[model samples]
Target chain A: MGAPFNYDVLDLTDEQVDAEVRVFGALTAAVRRLNEATLRTTVDHATVEEVRRQVEELTARLEKSMIPDNFGVSFTKGGRIRGYGNAVVGIRNPNAVPLTVVQDKVNGRASAEFELNALHEGPPGQVHGGVVALVLDQVFGEAAAAGGSPGMTGTLTLRYRLNTPLGPCSAEAWVDRRDGIKTIVKGELRRADGTVTVTAEGIFILPRWAREEIAKNGGTPPQFE
Target chain B: MGAPFNYDVLDLTDEQVDAEVRVFGALTAAVRRLNEATLRTTVDHATVEEVRRQVEELTARLEKSMIPDNFGVSFTKGGRIRGYGNAVVGIRNPNAVPLTVVQDKVNGRASAEFELNALHEGPPGQVHGGVVALVLDQVFGEAAAAGGSPGMTGTLTLRYRLNTPLGPCSAEAWVDRRDGIKTIVKGELRRADGTVTVTAEGIFILPRWAREEIAKNGGTPPQFE
Candidate 1:
């Protein structure tokens, strides 16, 4: 809303996006491995300090090479950001479950598939309840966006039907209704057995500034596909 | 009702926990800085590769010193895990917003304070809606636990009153009611000005196995103080 939500499509070709994806994807995997290492490492005090020193040196070297302030969002027409820099579905985020989302514009639906590991646990053997909510919010938000009514989340309600085990899972969402600039979306997270683990409903609203921008821009909604 | 929820407290001295917190806290901060660098770096492809190689080498070295399989939860008799290795409030987790939670045992209430950074952003300038849900779940779960009835989240409902800007925020939760083993908790996320950004109500259920474990262990509810 403040800066038109940065909807301008970046001028990047498919090949370029693919190349960036490959590189960033690898980097993301490395981070994931590093997280696991952090969780499972039990080195002695001296070794831990040694490792820290090495990492700090590397961090210092990288600090010298930086972009201007502000990490701009990269929006491509009919494409997701292939770089791992994306917060929701970015492969580079060790915290991310790295859902691969797909949108069906004709059906006003969105879905994603991912697997949670020990890294995402809450109560021992189960996936963290907060992680389930996070995934549902992302999927439902995508559904709202796919319905040609991109908006910010106004409310999200989740009912955990079962303890989502720490393993493979899938999620889907669809627009249930739309009222003016507000869209309601329904979504769920399921285990590999197709048993629903969590169900969610969310209301998304186009902010006043965004609504005005759309009106000024000839009433064109942001495209998800 | 699967495996008994791991509520067993570990026998660690305060000094030991403090040492772990210091070490892991430094590591977590470094990883957070690295994440920012990864997002904002504009170095040449070769340079990026070189940096990746260095990280990969460090990761490999750490991998050689593994600490068994699971990352055990650090639970002391009367203390929260100060180490950042905890999934929710752990400062060691670069992905975590690292909420500092406090529970009023007498009041049956829980409160958390945190600051969401660019790493937790979803909208152009707003905190990720999912992150809101995640924090609410944690706060509410803590509230339920603080109410002398520790349990797992069964449902969490959230109403976003506004687009929570990415910055300093706080949340609080209190027990609303209790039904058998289920506890209902109400909570809200607020800005420094006391503007409520999101409100939540969650149902937390003490599973059958956990109930039995409590009964067998003399019916003492897990302490949250």
Candidate 2:
């Protein structure tokens, strides 16, 4: 890799970070519930319009009362605050499947548990094939980053072996190899019954810009462990 | 790969499909607005809790009055009725980026246009890198299917060329080659100024089970054109 991952720890306590993550998690859960309701709601047109107006007004009110920008990612000595507004694993993103992941650096592996609700469906009863790709890519990237090299995704390859059914699913990934600036990771999504649904391989690279940014900031990147 | 694409005309007017698509598009747009607001809102704790409760109550009411489940994909004679509840491009999915895609079979190519809002952010002021993968996979799959080889994704490789900004972006994909069951498609996501942000190549395979399912059901598969 161009340079080792590094980050300067912030002076935040673990308790504070946990509380923040929990609060965001609650909000995301509520929003997810709302999203599903929106998809399946079939109320009369009048009722629908009324509810829409109320939601719009609420949005306007909140906008007027809230901060103007996002509180991007933050780091602390404990680790990279995992609950930053990440689209993939952020507890604050209602769009996320909100996978709970465990990275095992000693074993050079990472695993996640998640459920694909109706919101993720593609085929009538199966998970969207593309969603499968999305999950696999995230897990594989995590695996690559876990191996002491935090790099941006250079390439991701996936194989759909079977239709991933909607409901609980598990995924696991591991670093298969590394070549200087390139790190290759392999992973698979599996059903509860251990039936493999999708398999993936990805190549991650430490770009020059990322290296320069890390160097300029004088921050140490968090190790996957 | 497993079987050639096939389809039988259904009795559906283009007007009917367009009308339905538009209706769903409006609903998704509303939901998308709600999602963005949920992300950026920063009201006081008391007000936030109050709004959350109200949203919850509304959700409960809607649940009692709405449809029981999603109205999965539907096919029509004019085409595949591309506006099905697809997780990627379906107008019915509030979670989707809602890319507007046009598959030009006459030229053996496919392209899409979409915008990423604050909700899709990963890094500060930038579109989430995983989202780039998500969009590319869908476009590449569309390209493979556009070439008359409507298969599942076998493998997809993406190269991040530059940071995709959080705003209007366009992507295009085309078949590079085909080998029996495998179709290779190449694509790139570009900024409004035509700066290439990410490039990808994917291999798609028509699985044996999918071929059998089409044969069992009297349903004809939609052609890419």
Top lDDT hit: 1
State interface RMSD in Å for all models.
2.9, 5.5
Model 2 Cα lDDT, one tens digit per residue, A110-167: 8999888667766555677777877776777678777767666777777778777677
Docking quality level of the chain pair in candidate 2? acceptable
In the range B1-225, model 2's lDDT, one tens digit per residue, is 111223334577888667645554565677677677666766655666666777787677657775545545555766555435567776667788877778877655789988887667655556767778777777877787777777677777777877776778999999999887789898899997899988888888767766777777766554422
DockQ, every prediction: 0.48, 0.41
Q: Kindly list the per-residue Cα lDDT of model 1 for residues A22-79, writing each as its tens digit.
A: 6756666776677667666777656666767776776776678875433435566656
Task: State the C-alpha lDDT per candidate.
Answer: 0.72, 0.70
Using Cα atoms with residue i matched to residue i, what is each candidate's TM-score against the true structure? Answer: 0.87, 0.87
* Model 1 misplacement above 4 A: A1-4, A67-72, A76-85, A213-221, B1-13, B67-69, B74-85, B209-221
lDDT of 2 at A188: 93
The alpha-carbon lDDT assigned to residue A76 of candidate 1 equals: 65
Candidate 1 lDDT, tens digit per residue, B1-225? 234344546787888777877786677677667766666666666766777888898788778887554453547766655333445665555566677789877887999878776556565556778888878887888888778887888878888777676678999999999888779899899986789978888899866655675687674555433
- In candidate 2, stretches whose alpha carbon ends up further than 4 angstroms from where it belongs are A1-16, A65-71, A76-83, A222-225, B1-24, B65-70, B76-83, B223-225
RMSD of each: 3.3, 4.3
